[model samples]
Target: MRNLQHYTDDAFEFHKEVLKSKNTTKKDPSYKERIENMDDAIEGQFSAYNDNFVRNTLENIDSYGHTDDEKNDLLKLYSYKNSVIKNLKVKITTTAANRIINTCPNCTISEINSFDHYLPKDEFPEFVVNPQNLFPSCTICNGYKNYIWIEGGKRVFLNLYLDSLPAEQYLFVNLAITGDVITTTFYLQNNGDINNDIFEIIETHYNKLHLLERFSANINEVITSLENTIISFVGKLPLDEIKDSIIEKSNRDRIAFGHNYWKSILEIELANCVEYMNRFVTID
Candidate 1:
């Protein structure tokens, strides 16, 4: 997984814009007054989130604005997602989003199409419109990670804004080739490079998001594409040279993506597989 820069928009101002809009008041008559009354507490919660994120104590922060809400009227704040007033809907795609607009940070495979609440809005309604709490993600990853943040006193997923993703290799794949068919199984190992606690969180991120299974399912087409690319080089180069070229391609991919990028790692593994290389070796 990749880390992302936090949203830098003025969240409080945006919240005010939403609250002041006639559309918002028309939809939920009581929400404007209720939220205005709790403005201090809401701002405090924002401060708490920033402090907790910096201190790595997010799990310790208590849910605000939910202490007395029996009917959950505060949840209407989530309608900011549909707000067209003052072009607030565009706020979902922050400047940070442009960096990975097509690719998902959570999966690195799928196209990003939605924003996911890092802390579920249902449980932390105070952050429904909090820009810091939203992350751009694909629909599948968002669905897989729905409403799961902390469990057993540990954060269940890596915070893109807070966690520093290691550039060293952590994701690995074992490939099996039988005749013309190739199959792959992907898994993660720390390689003793990352902190144990952080690695555990990464493990949970993968498991909870079903990343490995998803990667495996999507890799066959990639493998076929790689094979086709490699075939083009068979008549022009020696087997050893072709493998070196593959290794070079992987190095470039690692630079473009990351050390553990599934495709880059897969290319490295493929380059090292003697049996696989023999396919090109005999062609020449």
Candidate 2:
């Protein structure tokens, strides 16, 4: 998983713009009171957020006599025609490369299709538009995560903008050969430099997202793609040369995509196996 830069927009100014735009729409009986409550919530959210703040805000919403329907209406402000939301989408989509497949830094297997409220908007309406609370994610990870990060008084997921991921390699793939077919088993290996809390967070993230199973499901495609490439090299190069070429490609992928990228790890491990090389060499 990778980290992203926090959005630089002034949070209060962003909230104000949404409110200003909403003022022009047809008003309801409780529109004025709803606007005032939203304004107060935005103002109160200027400080750092924590579990206590979330708990207090949820209680305050009830005390203010806001109905579920009223809160849902207020949540629409997050998607209102605002420059802040537009800019956030652009920044997230183009952050690390020309195109981001999945904007959720924790899982890279799928394409990004939605924004996940790091804290579910239903439960923490105050942060519905808080830039830090919005994470770009694939529909799958978003559904899997679904407001379940905090459990038993511990944060279970890694905050893409806040948590410091270990620089050393932790995710690894084990390669196994059965006759002509190859299979991969992905697992996490601890790096002693990383603290236990962060390690646990990664473990929880991997399990919650079902990353190992997801990656395994697609391993056949990866093997087929690699086999196609290796076949091209069969006659063009010697056995050792072909082996070196695959390893070089693997290293290049590792440099570009990170050590844990499925293809990178797969290629590196596949290159080292004598049976894999022999099988490729025997291909006509």
Candidate 3:
């Protein structure tokens, strides 16, 4: 999820929106569960999260001698569940730290537990509403890669908000007609400005997000196109002729031709996808 920078008022407005939806959820599936989950999430945004939070609040109230302002502050904090009715006396005054509030952009879920569908709420509950926690992934992506906890050793929750590394190199190649393919080499000789940075980002994106390397990613997607062309040629032949035609076409090694076309298409789609990648890797 991209970082969301909202004005102070927007957060309160977001809370009101949450309340209205919560009130109207009786028309949908698992309304009670949804509210409970939302209530928990809301509490996390406030002070104590889930059950641990409630116990802590009670303990705090009992242990400390309260000032008049402290009692009033707690009152406002308690009323915040209503979102719209949150008394202004509860405005956050302590830190100038930029808050990184987040919620999954894809959260249209009607079920309570399903609300944090894309977020690792069970593990990283504090980051549940953090914008960095939200990723622009497909539903299939979110479901398939659920809580990708890389096990073994000291287990830590997987971080999507990783600092990307610089690009070491980026180069492209095409098979030569009769000789070796063009050895397009982009070297990380001198220190280019952002080469390493871009590389790090791509590497992280590749490993975490499963974006393939250029050789694997770019060439593989066109295998079907190559198959289609070869099949079409063979389909026009007799049974005995089909085998020969298929062999003949494949032996010609037109996979290079397919690669050329694919590379051109990719360049058109994102002009700097290859060139900029190389530029960063190649130091002056």
**What are the per-residue Cα lDDT tens digits for candidate 3 across 119-196?**
354444433333222333344335545775333321122222232222222323333222311222111222355554
What would the per-residue lDDT of candidate 1 be over residues 1-284, giving only the tens digit for each residue?
Answer: 55666756667766666667534446556767777887887788888887887786789988864764722655665542455321432443344425323578788899776778888888888877777777777899999998889998889998887888888788999999999887889999987879998889989999999989988888877777878888998888777887888889888877666567888788789889998878776664
Q: How much is the lDDT of residue 222 in candidate 1? A: 73
Q: Which candidate number has the best TM-score?
A: 1
Per-residue lDDT of candidate 2, residues 1-284 (tens digit): 56666666666665666566554445565664666666665566545453333342222222233468767766877762466666676676574667744435667777666777777777766677767677777789989998686766677777776777776777888887888667788998896877888799889989898998887777887888777888898988898887788889877766655556666777767777788878866666
Clashes of each: 0, 0, 15
Can you give the lDDT of residue 74 in candidate 1? 50
Question: Which candidate model has the greater lDDT, 1 or 2?
Answer: 1
Alpha-carbon RMSD, candidate 1: 3.2
Q: Would you estimate the TM-scores of all the predictions?
A: 0.86, 0.82, 0.33
TM-score of 1: 0.86
lDDT of each: 0.76, 0.70, 0.33
Q: What is the lDDT for 115 in model 3?
A: 19
Q: Which is superior by lDDT, 2 or 3?
A: 2
Off by over 4 Å in 1: 18-31, 65-72, 79-100, 282-284
Candidate 3 TM-score, C-alpha based: 0.33
